[model samples]
Target chain A: MNRLTALVIAFALLLFAPARALDIQLTSGDWQPINIFVELFLGEENLNGQIPSDIIADDLTVSGNFRAYKENQNHANAMSAERLGDIRNRGGEYLITGTVNNKSGKQYTLSFTLYDTLTNDKIGSYSIVFNNENQRLVAHNVSNWIYETILSKAGIFHTKVAYVVRHEDGTNELKVADYDGHNRLVMLTSQDHIISPTWTANGNSLLYVSFEQNKPVIYQQSLLTGERSIVANFKGSNSAPAASPDNRTIAAALTEHGGLQQIYLLSGNRKARLRESKGIDTEPVFSPDSKHLAFISDESGSPQIYQFNLDDNKTRRLTFGSRYNVSPDYSAQGDVLTLVRRDENGDNISILDIRNGDTIPLTNTASTNSPSFAPNGDVISFIDDRNKKNLATVSVNGKVIVFWRDSEQGEIINPSWSPIKSDWF
Target chain B: MKKQNFASLATIFFALVLTGCAASKGAYSGNIEDDRSGEAGLAPVSAGTAGKASSPGFVKSSTIDDERTSTDSLLQKRIIYFDYDKSAVRDEALPILHTHAEFLNNKGGAIGIVLGGHADNRGSNEYNLALGQRRANAVRDIFLSYGASANDIEAISFGEEQPRAQGDNESAWQENRRVEIRYTDE
Candidate 1:
């Protein structure tokens, strides 16, 4: 959201003094993706390592903001001014060269230097020493650093995604993995159903609904220690748990109040009902600023998304044309909200800009549910069940779409992308 | 709850399978690595296995046992089907529900009953859960009005998680959108 920072100022000043005949800019809109080249990482004994470099290139390309290419050679002087001129001639705007040092048996050090090819200026350098088992993560961190330094926004390469996978025997497993659906760790396996898995504000725990007790109950479980405690276990359904930006409060849809679903703000040992509606109200999601809550209510005859402000205690309808709309989530910037709408065609994902009431459909497939936004607000993830059940992610601009499935036999649903990985990981 | 116990349980299950002590029919027989075969940018093109029966019946059967009495015949219709998205009990379903209510009311003591509400896999899961709860509440209110004790009935919604049919068609949806009257023997 902070578009006019010192980095943008430096970019603007450099833009006036034209370094090359090719036009290049670092902004979010219709600008083309900058071409970046990564030279193979130089190993400690000139072993010619390609693991980290390959991961870095793939990360940049998957981001959709950069077209990354890997050079065939690796050396200290690979980016000499002559070679840099050649790169500029071929529309390469950035270059990354790194070194991999294998310290001891399982420890490794990856050091990278970023350069702006057009201006021939050294942008920055990052060094990460990690266990060899975390090679992919360390490489992703390097890519994140390069991305933040260039685009002035955090990259989601290091984040994780939590989802539910139903096995062939009707057992549901709650799994968390890297953003690309690798390095999966099963959090819980139960014969009951699990729904609405969300990350805590600090990214240390997850809150979800499980039917293990023969009724839906919300539980907050730590990802590190695997310890969990029940958050809500009312008489009726306690589902759709949404944690606020502050680590204190949780918004959930509970039916304990007169047996009809209503939104409630739960904090510590106190619970306060927020809305009094005659119809069904569930799926309460908090804005990034924690000043407003968006939820699905059928008070208007059909399920539709509504936003309620915490300050004024006033509510406004968000979606008008749809007879069925639910599962509302806000982007990190709190500018846009993603939801699923059902019509004569089928259930599909759509995004609504709060500033202007413009709604754009993201997917046309039926059975799409639980659309969630990435921390960077550039991508949205949802479950698509048109032909096969799978987790899908689409760029906010709808230009790039990717699907992920755990296996060929089970059903994967309820995907929630986590915030950027904290430093503890 | 701790998740490490899941790993331990899985280890025990694998041990049981190795020793041929567990049911080999429905057990997961594939390698552990097979569950983690999701590629980075590709979706699997293989078809999923056929869905099995998932009706949440406690101990009741759809057919009568021994001599078919009138009460047994009435109780045989445990499932009360509903129209799509409508929770109101159909006219044809009222006679069986009345019989259940009278049977529970005339009993000497409290006999627990659970109404497991379900929906077709058509809408959002959360919304479907809400709809199922509504259907369960509707049936519970009718039972209460017909002289059934409120203390003896508990209603819970399973949403679309437990579907009796697997096909993505109107027939399957109609079969799935119903409430099952389960008698919990105390």
Candidate 2:
């Protein structure tokens, strides 16, 4: 019998049976926590459906809800309508079933359906036809749809991530791609080396370090035009270039005379020294108001993040939990600051609430570095090297979604999210 | 009483051995006894050679060759200092530059020389790399004007990666802000 007909017959049988005390007890209690099981079938056959099922489970768990279960055996033949009724009676609130078929060449067709276990009725259905390379993204969109249908909130499945990928020979390149590792593009390529790619106020341009001329110089590049130029040139070294919220000015760490590296402001051809410290001060980031700067310095004999007031030129230390805290990025709302904190154990990403200065750990998974915030400031993108390869983009709650996942390609590191989409040609 | 005397002798022997090892390695060499020969009129030697002389007890005679000895002697007679953030041979470095120029003019042909420029690690690595290249180029230009062939010289910048001192103080930075001239041939 067809799967739908079998499910209907099973539901009729369960309805005819008398309601037992156990059945009532199972149906009560907050709907049994809603476990959604997604299976992928390819052209009337099953082709390693467990992998995609596991990926969906991981994405759903990011919400801190949902207990997803995957049946070990292929259910394409064994799961009859009676089994569906039994699952419904056992408190499995929702069931998601899908099929993946390889069309011509790299093309693929994925069919999915979501069913309400309580009534054994089909709630929604979706069909995605795409290339094999886009399979992960299709899964991401499917997960997002499932999330929205259940929670009434929009999903971030379609968002892109930007990061720096460096080779063992010290060749650094900037890359941007979909969060699930599709449509990868190289933003900046240099033979010398590149570090710390930061997105402009609008996501159209990126500001980063390039050693094309044999020194650490900051450059701003247009993503569309592929044209780049030096933004600031200082005598000793220039690094950690961060654009302000208004895009009117840039804040960078510049070494002057014989003093320590300090924060400086750049506007056209004019340069203004913002802070004068006797210790090593570097890694400058600006607040949304552009009136204050956050940076890392070794003035205390160890690296720590500090905040400097623009109007009065006063400075204050922002991080107190660790002796080594560097690469601080302020949120768009100006309420949260994300930074990489390192101690004796290892490095991890932590978020600091500006209102109360309470620091919280975001990634306890592995050695996390280079944390950058999305335009909305709700999710954070960072590089995690625990899996042997430098994979980028770990969610604020430590759910790592790999960007550009083809194993044949090199690794990705140091992600900087653009403030907004760029209009520059 | 006999045991006490033996302990004192052993202590003395150990102290002698420690002193022997310290002198043999020649690690401490910053002591000078002044004997005025009324040679105050002599030009003050450059800091590079002065540093070498102050630590004479540490450096062995085998490492001091005739060419290096002569260069050290000449460097003492002339001082070269660059302008702030500039690699161009400043007027202050003219005396030393002229000395090297005359030497290259006299010797000539097939000599390979390297100009190593360094920064104080104040800026980003990229900017410092460029600044260091500029400094080396400046010295190369001066050497060329003084009769050194372009084929015989090469310039490279280290861009604040290596420093002479390890502290964040100004004195340490001043010492690190420099370029070294190295010649592979006499």
Which candidate number has the best TM-score? 1
Give the C-alpha miss distance for residue A343 in model 1, angstroms: 5.4
Largest lDDT belongs to which candidate?
Answer: 1
Chain B TM-score against the true chain B, candidate 2: 0.57
Alpha-carbon deviation at B133 in model 1, angstroms = 0.9
DockQ of 1: 0.14
Please write out the lDDT profile of model 2 over residues A318-422, one tens digit for every residue: 888676677788876788899877756667788888778888777665477778776556567666665524444544544333333423345565666655445
Once fitted onto the true fold, the runs of candidate 2 whose alpha carbons sit more than 4 angstroms away are A1-35, A41-139, A147-154, A256-258, A267-270, A286-292, A308-316, A331-334, A362-368, A374-388, A398-412, A418-425, B1-186
Candidate 1 lDDT score at position A381: 81
Highest DockQ: give the candidate number.
1
DockQ of each candidate relative to the true complex: 0.14, 0.02
Across residues B1-186, which tens digit of lDDT does each residue of candidate 1 receive? 232353245334433442342123222221222123332322111111111111122233455333224554787678989999899999899998998888777753334577878899887888888888788888988998898876567677778877899888999999999998876542
